[model samples]
Target: MSPSLLAALLYAALTLLLLMTIAALRATLVITRQRTADAFTPAGDDVSPFSGRLCRAHANCCENLPVFGVLVVTAALSGHADITDPTALWVVAARVGQTVTHLGSGRRRAIRLRFLFMLVQIALLTTWAARLLWGAMQ
Candidate 1:
């Protein structure tokens, strides 16, 4: 198969992986929320990880995944995979960073690293999209 086709398939696979991660995160948040709500007391604080802006965080992450996926797919479909290596590497690195953050030590540190990785991933994807658009216009 052609390089472009392979790149497209890889991007699609990454998108699916993102979807699956979102689903799992949602489920975990739901359980956490339910437990917190059920255990609420008159004098005690419901210190649930799911209570403070986690839904928004998850939503934001989900939003970016599709944007990245679309850009990568479009570039690959437009015969731009040769130029897509940098973006693909960025995506892969971001994924690895995310996994490490999720499974590594230091919650605060992990959170910051994950956010940075996501930002880098978004930037890479946006750059790829802009390049593809410029090429199309040429």
Candidate 2:
């Protein structure tokens, strides 16, 4: 498989890991009788600060996955995976960095760092898409 495809799969795995974390945290709360299962909100603030961050992180992944996936898959389908391969793994690394920074702290510096990581992913993906488009036009 191409590195671009592998990167996309890694991104999916990371997203799933975040989801499982939310589930485990909620389950622990319910089991301890600290809260009811139905009491959890989509915003996750009803639970804890970390839960809220977790929700946001998971949502971020969900939002960006398709954007990255479409580009990677399209490149592969059109035999342009080479265009995306160089920086594809870097995008995934940046994504993980963003999520870790998000979950690590709510401080200003952490937020800034998280935003930087997000920008890296966007820049890489945007460049990849442009290259793919240019290649297809040839």
| lDDT, candidate 1, 29-130, per-residue tens | 568674433453322224334422333343444556576557666776777876676457657667556644644534787789878877777677777778
Question: Per-residue CA lDDT of candidate 2, range 12-127, in tens?
Answer: 99999999999999999999999998999998977889889999999999999999999998988887887889899999999999999999999999999999999999899889
Residue 108 miss distance in model 1 (angstroms) = 3.5
Ten residues in sequence with the least summed lDDT for candidate 1: 42-51
Alpha-carbon RMSD, each predicted model: 6.3, 0.9
In model 2, the worst 10-residue window by lDDT is 129-138
